[model samples]
Target: MGFTVRQIARRADGGEIIRTRAFDGAELSVGRGSDCDIQLADLGLMLRHARLRLAGDGRVAVEAMGGVPLEIAGAFVTRADLDPGDNPTIMLAAHRLTLARGEDGGVLVTAERVLAAGDGSDAASEAQVFTLKKTLPSKRRLAWGLVVLILGLGLALPLWVMAGRQTVLPPALVTAAARNAAPVATPASGWQPDRVWSSGPLSTAHAGLANSCGACHAKPFEATTDTACIACHTPAAIPAHAPAARLARGQVPATGLVADVHKAFNLPEGRCASCHKEHEGPDGALQVAENFCTDCHRGLAARLPDTRLANVPDWGGHPAFKPTLVVQPSLTAPRFERVALAGARETSGLVYPHQLHLSTRNSVANMVRAQGLPGKNGLLACNYCHVPDSDGERFQPISMEKNCAACHDLAFARDGGVVRTLPHGKPEQAAGIIRDFYLGQALSPRAGVAAADRRLPGSEARLRTLAFTSPAQARAQADAAIAGIFGKGGTCAECHAITDTGGANLLTRFAISPVTLADHYLPKGRFPHKRHLSYDGRTGDAACISCHSGVPRSNLASDVLLPPLSQCATCHGGPQLATAAPATCATCHGYHYGESGHGGDALRVRLVVARRGE
Candidate 1:
C-alpha cells in the first residue's frame, strides 16, 4: 500500500548510520536532489533519476527519468518490473538500491554508498590546472616592475618637463624677452606629462592657464600667492568681505586633517585660492563648499564678542531680518535705522491703508471694477500699485503719478477740451497753476452775454458781478480753493502729510512733508522676486499672498509687511534638510560684497600687453 526507503551510510570510524522513512503512497521518487524520497550525492546522477511504483500484482515498477538508464543484474533498462518472490538491485552512480517486499505488503527500497568520497582519480591532469603559475612571472617581480614604471611616468617625467621650461613669464620679463629675443623654434603645444598632476580639466574661468601652469603655480611645489591674484584684481573689483582686522578676529579656527595639512604648509585661514579652487572642470568654477561658511558663521559670536552678526548654523537658526527703516522723516535727508521686522515701522510721510485698498469687498475694489481699473479677477491685487523693477529683485519706486493716478487723478478743471491736472510734488507750482486758472476765468468776458443790457463804458464797474469778477475777488477765490486742496479731506492731503506755515501768500503757506521709502529692506541679502513669482503651481495673486499674508490685513502704510523668517522656512531650509529647498549662505549673500572682480581673462591681459607695446 506504501513505499519505505532505508539509507545505510558507513562512517569512517566503522559505524553504520541507517535512516528509514516511509511514504504512504503507491509511488516514490529517487534523485540526487534533496527533495527526492530517496536522495543521493552523486554528480553523475540526474536530479530526478528514477521513480518507483507498486504494480497491481504487487510487483515493484522502476522507471528512469530524463533518459537515465538504471542498471539491474548487469543489464541496463529504462523500465523494469521486480516481483516480491524475486528480489532485484539497481545501480545509481556511486550508490546501489535493493528492492524487496515490506511487512505491510508494500515496496521497500534499501540504498547504500558503495564508492568512497574524495576519490579524485577521474579528475583532469594537474599540468592543465596549474598552467597560469608556471607560465606568468612571480607576483613580487611584477609588483616591482609596476613601481618602477609609475615612478618614471608620474614623477621623473613631470620633473624633467617642469625643469626644461617655465610656462609663463612675468609681464616685465616678457617685455624684456620680446626686445632681445631672436627667431627660435618652439615646442609643439600639446599635452604635457606635468598635466598628469591635475585632478580634472581646468574650470572655464581658468581654462587659459591649462598649459601655462606657472601663471598660478609660480613655484613648483608652493601654494598660489595672494600677491599674484592682487596684481590683476583691483581692490574696487574684489573688496574684502569685511574689514580685514575684524574678519581675522571673527574667523573660526580651522580643524581636522585638511586644516592640519594647510597649517603645515604655512597656509593661513583666509586665502583667496582656498575658496576659489581650480582644476575641477568648467562647471565647478567659483563653487564653495557649504561648510566653508557654516564653520565660521555657526558660532561667530563666541569667537568675537563685539560682532553685530548673530550666529546662524542653518536657516532654522537664522534670526529675524533687520530691515533698514527710515526712522526719522526729514525734508532733505531722512535718518534710517536697522530695526527687526517684529515691530519695524517706516515713516514715509504718507497715509495709506492697505486693508482699504486690498479688500475685495470694499469701495476700492468696487471702484476698480466699476471704472475698469487694473486688478486680478476684478479684485484689487498687489501688482496694481506695486511693480517689480527691471531685475525683479525689488520693486520700482512708487510714483504717485504713475501708480496712483489711474484711480486718484489730480485734474481740477478743464480748459476747452484739455483737462488741467494740478502739478504733483511741488505745492508752489500747484498753487500758481490754480491761481492763474481762476484769474484767467475771472478776467475773460461771458460767452453768452447781451451787450444791450450793459451800461456805457465809463459808467460800467470794472468788478462786474454777472459778467466778470475783479482781480481781488479772483485772488480771494484762488486762495480759498488752494487752502481746501492742501487742507484735510482734500486731494493733496489724502496721501501726503500737509503742514500749513503762516505766510502772506497761498504759495508759501502749504508745505508737503518729504517722503523717503526704502528701495531695499535687507540690503545684505538678495531676494529674487522673479524666481518667487510662482510657488507650488500657484501663480499671480495666490503666489504673492503665500508670502505677503500680512499685506491685505495691514491698515497702516508704516507697517512692515515683509514676511518673517518662518515664511521662508516653509519652503527653504539648510543644505542638509531634505524636506525643504536647500539654501546655503552663498544663496543669499556673496563673499565679495563690492563690484565683481575682473582681469582674470588671459585674452584681456594679452590685449593690454599689446596696447602697452610690451
Candidate 2:
C-alpha cells in the first residue's frame, strides 16, 4: 500500500486549489526537510517530525520522532492510533494535516495552511490583518516600472547611439596611407552606449569586426546572414558542400522541440554562422561538434539514394581507403583508377625491388657502404631515396641523378684524362655520344687505320685497304655498343622500360617509357607525416616502418605499400571512444578541401561523387 498526500491552498476568491501526490512505501514520513516524504516549509517544524505506519489492530499508528509532540484534536500526545473511516486533524506549527483512509487500503493525508484562519464571524478583521495595502506599493506598479526601465536602457539607448556611428574599414583593405593619416575627430568616435550590447569579444579572425557591428548584423533584430560572410569570403574561396538540390535532399530533417521552434521561426539551414559561431573570445577555436556531421552522414544513404558515398557514422564505420593509381602506363596520357589498397597496383614504367635495396646483408647493401651512400650499417634507409617535400607532409619525387646516379654509374668511355658519361634521361643523346667516340677512334692513327710509319715500299696498298675497312668496322662497333646499352642488363634498361622504335640511325632506334608516380595516393583523405613523426617514442625509419610494415618484404614495384584500414585502428577509434584517440570525420577529411596544397587534390577530388559532374 502507498501513502496519498494532498496539499490544499486557498485563493483570494475564497476557492481551494489542491495538489495530490502518491508515495509507495511501508511508512509515511513528515518533516520540514526536503528529504521527508511529506515536507513542510515552516522553520518551526523539526527535520524528522513524525511517521505513520500500519498497526496490528488494522489501525494507523502516528509516532512522533526526535521527541517532538504531535497535536491531534488540540491534545498534545507522543503517539496516537488512527482508525479507518475516522478523520483526525493534527496541528504542527502553522500547518493542519487531516488524516483519513485511502481508497486503496492506505492512509490519506490532507495538509493546509491555517496561519491566517480565524472564526467565521470576524472575517473583516482577519482580512485587514493579512492585507498588504498599508505595507508597500502594489506589485503591478513595480512590474510595469521595471519593464519601462529595461526597454529605455537596453533597446532605446542602443538604437539612439547606433544611428550616428562611423563605419570602420576592414583590416585587410586598410592602406598604409590611411594608417599614417591624422585621425578625423567626430562625435561618434567617443564612447557609445551601443558597445554595452556586445555579447562578448570577437574571435582573432574577426577581431577587426569588433567595432563594426553593421558588417555582420545587416538588419536589426535579425541574425547574421550568409551574404555578410560572402562579402569577405568569395564563392570560389569557399565553395558549397554540394549543389543546392542534392545538398537539400541529403540533409537530414531536424526533429525535437528545439527544431520545431526553429521551423516555426522559418530558420534556414546551411548558413555559415550556424557552424562557425563568433563573439566567443579573441583566440577561441571554432570547433564544430561531431554530432553536426554524424547527424546527416550516419544514415546518408537512406536519405540520398543515388549517392555513391558509403554511410560513415564514425571512425569505426569508415571504409578502406581508395588511392588513385595509374592502371595503364602511358607517356602522353596515363589512365587512372581509384582502387582499394588490397587490389591496388601501379604500373609506373619502372622496376624497383624495395626488398633488394633495403637489405642490410646483401650485395646492394655492400655496394652502398663501399660507395659511402646514404645508409646506416650498410642498410639503405627510406630517406636515402625518398626525401620529404618542403612541408614535410609528403615525399618528393625520386630522381635518377640525385638518388640513383652515384650507385648506377653511367660512364661508358674515358678520354685522355676525362671520363665521359652518358646523359641520364636523353637516350638519343647517349647513343650519339657513343657513335661519335667510336667514329673518332676509327680514323685516329692509334687505330692503325691509315698509318704509313715504319712500313715497306709496297705497304701503301695495305694502308688504303685498312682505311676502307675501318668505316665499316666503326659502324659495326657503334651498332654493337648501342645495342648493349639499350638491351637487357644494360644501365638504361635495368630501371626503365626500353622500347625499340626502329629508325634509320642508331640514335633514334630506342625510346625509354615514361614513368608516373603519384605524389599523393589518397587525394580525398589527409595524412600528415610530420604530425606522426614518432610511434610509441620510436622516430625516423622505425616510426615509418610501424605503419608501412609491408615495404621491407615487398619485391614488386607494382605492389602498393599503403597501410590498410586495420593499421589506423591501432591508435584511433570513434569520437566517443575513450580507449583510443577520438577520430571525427573532420579529423582526416576536410569538408570543402583536403591537405596543405588545397588547390591540388582539394579541387580535384570533391567529397561526394554525385556532385563531381556538376
Q: How many clashes (backbone atoms < 3 Å, residues ≥3 apart in a chain or on different chains) does model 2 have?
A: 0
Cα TM-score per model: 0.65, 0.65
Whole-model lDDT per candidate: 0.71, 0.71
Which window of 10 residues has the lowest lDDT sum in candidate 1? Answer: 605-614
Residue-by-residue lDDT tens digits, candidate 2, 495-522 = 8888887776777878788887766777
The candidate that wins on TM-score is 1
Which residue ranges in model 1 land beyond 4 Å of their true spot?
1-149, 156-192, 201-212, 255-260, 279-285, 330-332, 361-363, 370-373, 445-468, 595-614
**What is candidate 1's local distance difference test score?**
0.71
Would you list the clashing residue pairs of candidate 2? none
Clashing pairs in 1: none
| Candidate 1 lDDT, 73-135, residue by residue in tens | 899999998885577889888789988888988878899877666542112232444468767
